[model samples]
Target: METIQVVFLTVLVFFVIVTIHEWGHYYFAKRAGILVREFAIGFGPKLFSIKRGETRFTLRLVPAGGFVRMAGEDPEIVDVSEGQTVALRVKDDKVTRIYLDRLDERSGVVRGEVTAIDLERDLFVSLDLDGEIERFRVHPQALMISKGKETQIAPIDRQFGSKSVGARAMAIFAGPMMNFILAFVLFAVCVQMAGVPKENPDKLFVGSITDKSPASGSDLKRGDTIFAVNGTPIGGNFKLMVDIINKSKDTAVKFDIIREGVKHSVNITPAFDKESQSYRVGISADPQTRPATFMETFTIAGKQMKVWTINIFEGFKKIITAQFKLSDIGGPVRTAQYTSQFAAEGIDKLTFWTAILSLYLGIFNLMPIPALDGSRLIFIGIEAVRGRPVNPNRESMVHFIGFALIMLLMVVVTFNDILLLVRGEQ
Candidate 1:
């Protein structure tokens, strides 16, 4: 039951983030007068689909990611010779009929019944010719008919390639931008709803002191307010005070405490704990928080976003510098577990993590790796500089390779996550 809930929460969050990201592309593409073929959530076989306003919106089986399929983004070269049959549509007719064995090698004009009519493909009609079905790929503006002789190509104006460089960049960048916007908004809402921490500056009151700990042997007591540490004013930052104490490994640190309206100084030495890998004073304090005003909430949210963004960059740096272990990386399984744990804690925690995940997703997608929006932007940048687009086939191959590598990485990380889970269970 718990696993089911975790899976459900994970899927829900994934769907929401991916849908918004794709919608960003769809919204900008349409605004830029580009034809969006499909706006799909998830990948692989479509589970459900609907056509509206020249775009097919679909839900697919896999929830890993989604995409906005713009026209001519990855155009396919249809091998007409491989097709055994041809579909033909009558001029000014909405319906198509397919005819079998209508191909004549000597003459061009062959009549056939159109078996399938796809309105989303811009009057794309399929027909069964010579006992095999084949689709005629033609631009929406210019319909073509071949008489068993030659093929004609019609250039479409509304394709992605036809769009200006600026427009193309906007469309590609919109996805990540939307993700950032999502994270920001979520953070703001969470702050407003949950309130911001309002630490008391007058004193840092100790909530508890561990038994048989260094703090227990010292003059520190519950309800005692710490005013300073090692002669440095602690201020209202509990983290700073804790850091000072933790860094005092085997060294006595002076603590200025105020208890019962009296001040006293005490020196306590912290012992290093190998298991936790930190010097322990073993005292905990409670942080006070108050509901934030509307403007304050926004300010807090903005600061939170900035801090988390920097943290992500730092984390990446650590990983690159080998300071962070690769096995520490978590995939979907670990993410789901965290989501579940957060959900169990409360809605506020879940919402906060959702914002964090959104920000991470946005930042990660902006990485200039192949198969990502950043990489696509790179190609677009090159095109802008050269005044011409890169060969679509080559660009497509690069994206394919990048996508394969990303999948491989996901597999490795997922395996690591599973191993960690198994170890935890044991």
Candidate 2:
């Protein structure tokens, strides 16, 4: 039952994050007058779908990722000319399908049976349209159709490629921007509920002691109040005590502590940790916290967001500089595991971690990698500079390759995640 609860919570968190991310693109694309054909959550065979206005919203089987399909985002081009009979599948006055085969221009009407429809590729074919048999490649953009004459083309305003560079950039950038917004909101809520830390300078209270460490070997224990270090009085200055201990580094330091109202002195030597490049006595101090006012909550949350944002960038820099190992990178599985663990802790911790995860997602998506929003912005930047869009075929190919490489990386990361789980790392 506990396992089931964890799994459900993990899935819920993943769904919420992905849905919001994709909705950001859908919202901005619509605002920019770009025709969004489908706003889908997840990938592969869709479990359900419904058409609303010009968009078909869908939920797919796989929960790994989602996407917004926009018109003119691909390389395909539709050409319509005079003297050629084109059969169109119309529904509710909308051109739902287009026939590629040239119709007998003499036939005023053609009839055909619908053979197949490829939703992913947006391709459709019919055996006949009003007695005319033809193959048709469906146009992705929504269109109005009239029977005998040439099919009315999708409006230029509805095409993504026709939008201004600023509009295009906004649409592409909205996904990551929404992520940051989500993180801020979540963090604000957490602060409002749990308050912010209010550190005490005078009192030094040990919260926990690492087992088998120098502090643990001594008379020091959790909840012990330290009044002074060595012969010098701490005078409630926690920083002073910390500075002395850390500066001592492998040197013995005498601590004047009060345990259950009994004054005692204990000598503890600090150990140097290579990873953090810090000296520690293995004792964690309790941080004082107080309820924050509404406005104060937002201020704290904003500061938290800024700090986390810088940390994420620094982490990426470390990875680039080889200071971080790729093997430590977590994928979907690891994310789900962490989400489940945080959820098990309590709502406060869960919300805190969610904010951090959202921030990370936002920053990571902004990386100028192919198949990502940042990569799309790069093309838009080129268009702005050149005053014209890049060749559709070439741009599409680049995105395709980038997408393939991203998938390969995901597979590798996922495999590592599973291996770590098998090895009991998580």
Q: Evaluated with lDDT, which candidate comes out highest?
A: 2
Model 2 earns a TM-score of 0.69
Give residue 152's error in model 1 in angstroms.
17
Taking the tens digit of each residue's C-alpha lDDT, what string does model 2 give over 1-426? Answer: 287777787788888778888889999999988888789998789899988887889999866788998877874345534334445655554446455464444243333555543423454444444666555554545343445322223455677888888988998889889889999999999887766566554566776577667887888876688888877787556678778988888789999888989999999889887777888788877544578888898898999999999999998988788896666888888988889877765667688888898888778788898988888889889988998888988999999999999888888999999999999876
Each model's lDDT = 0.76, 0.76
- Candidate 1 on 257-294: residue-level lDDT in tens? 88899999988898887888988787887444588988
Please report the candidate that would top TM-score against the real structure. Answer: 2
Q: What is the lDDT of residue 262 in candidate 2?
A: 94
State residue 334's C-alpha deviation in candidate 2, in Å.
1.3
User: How many backbone clashes can be found in candidate 1?
Assistant: 9
